[model samples]
Target: MKSEPVAGVRPEVKRRAEQGSQQLQGEVQKLELENLLRTKFPFDAIEPVPKGEFGGDVLHRVVGAGGQSGGTILWEFNRTKNWSDAWLAKLRDDQRTAKAEIAVIVSQSLPKDVETFEMVEGVWVTHPRAALPVAMIFRLSLLEVALARQSTEGQQTKTEMVYQYLTGPRFRQRVEAIVEAFSTMQEDLDKERKAIMKQWAKREEQIERVMGATVGMYGDLQGIAGKPLQEIEGLSLQALDAPVVNNRSAAE
Candidate 1:
């Protein structure tokens, strides 16, 4: 029997659905990784909590490699644009009250080009690196809220200032100077690692060449020593260098 023609879906619709699904999955994965990183490295810095989780408002900057006293201060804003003027004033006051030495901004609205705090350039800034503000800000605010809970013990339900510090411009400048110096140092280290790799590669090539030459010579000697010509030459044999020195091939 002839059946009615079924409605067909457009290629564009399928593509869009796939793209949206991929985006949602990526966001979910990012949040999970951020949470895992935060949990494992909690004491180091105030990492952004996953969306729909607590501690989205508090931003934590690492002191050093997840180990050290007096870790840097971190802060995040609230989503929903629900922050009251009074609360903001209180946060400003807290910023003054906490008297933190360094401030790290990890907002989703922040530009990727931002390396460090505007007030202090040495400090590293780690925004969500996402192009969407609403999502990033929401995540940042979520982290902020999480941090606030820890600081205030859930006494203040709504978002409030987590910390504030009164420090001199010199301190900010020092932080910037340190960050700049650290950047330079990291560059130097990378260059050194590459250089070392190159040198090792060269040495490895030389060792392989010498080993090949020795194998050829050994085959010639073995032929003279009455070994089967085919057996001596066809085997994958490697001969050691003179001085019987230990060969540290980069390949090894």
Candidate 2:
């Protein structure tokens, strides 16, 4: 039987892949155009054309114009062969940009490869070797732009921690069930704990009142002038010496 395409892949997935491929092609074509333009001799001159004839005329013109010769120009152009399709394709596919960047450092060829990296907060962090050919370097810059655009999708589908734990079919129903159970048990536990704490607090107040009366009686016996006050000085020190009793202290 003939093989068929796998099912369940949404049409949008295919569309996105196609769109990415198209973009890659357009980028590659732009690189090629830049490389070709760079090769044209009059790229910086008044007229955008080869300056002189190829053979003898070029030689005589160069010799007559100045000290430099046609051979020197040819040699310079040959050196620029670094800006080739093969090199650009290498850069496009290479995942280990670090190695390539290292090679760029040793070569010290193109100024375009000297890149200024910025922080996430938009601060200039570092400027690394921008040593690759201009066309390839510019094309690689596009990858950073593509990465920024791709990151937005992650933000678009951003989920809270609770959502991650409780997602999928029947999610809301299961979550509600769990929440209802927790709520019911939690309320009873909280009520019992609060009641226990309230009882302790009542006992604590009674003890304080009794201690206040005792202090007053002692002051009266000691013949002090004013009503004696129950000044609880650093009872927290006593509590600290005692064993920890739950998050709320028994004395507290």
Candidate 3:
């Protein structure tokens, strides 16, 4: 069945609402990425790009002490409802402007061909949660490339083999495996969390139901036995309400 626009709602209002939501979601993902890169990731330096800059949103670097290690990874995060082809072109341009060797776009929406992550038009496109694994792979690639450069003088064939492996489909498979594992773990955690919450809610309802029955039974005993009925501590509200009743009597 086809759905129509919400009754009596302006299209402009809906558009603004969606834009606001997307902006908020993007901010949250950006903050999370910052924390992971700063604390957990192996990047030697992490830099946040300023707004309206002609570069990527974040710049990450792996620096080795006067050794074979120097590369920059550019990152862009998006949370829009749909994927935009323009994003890939723009990030590529930003990658060049920032002189980053690897450019990654972490978006909520992926291109039709991409499921978890993929190299599209020379740029990496991935789900926001899978961004770390992608970054790690690229980070390792940079480190390995550095090592390869140092060793290539003596073993050119071996270095070329390593380079070939890094760029091959096998490398992409490894990334997909890591991303799939992380995504599965996250999905399981969410399910467990929701199940536990549902259980708590059900238990609360049962408790409330039992209390209601108990209170009703107490009231019935009072009606049947009149003054001879014993008052239950928590269930009997008459004693507490007696003073209010007497005050009203006095007022009358």
50 Cα displacement, candidate 2 (Å): 97
Candidate with the greatest TM-score versus the true structure: 3
The lDDT per prediction is: 0.48, 0.37, 0.80
TM-score of 3: 0.53
Tens-digit lDDT string for candidate 1 (1-252): 997755565677888898788667655655654565467555555555345543324444443332433333435442221213333333333333344333333433333344422332233234444312333343454455445545665465333322321144344544655675699899999999999999999999998898788777867777797655445433344423223345575346
List candidate 2 segments past 4 Å from native: 1-173, 224-252
RMSD of 3: 19.1
User: Given candidate 3, what's the lDDT at residue 44?
Assistant: 70
Off by over 4 Å in 1: 1-168, 228-252
Q: Candidate 1 at residue 83, lDDT?
A: 19
Of candidate 3, the 10-residue stretch with the lowest lDDT total is 168-177
Worst 10 residues of 2 by lDDT: 55-64
The better-scoring model by TM-score among 1 and 3 is: 3
Q: How close is candidate 2 to the true structure, as a TM-score?
A: 0.21
lDDT of 1: 0.48
> Model 3, range 98-170, lDDT digits (tens) per residue?
7677889988899997999999977899998788888778888888777766766665687787887698644
The TM-score ranking, best first, is 3, 1, 2
After aligning candidate 3 to the native by TM-score, how far in Å is the CA of 53 from where it should be?
Answer: 3.5
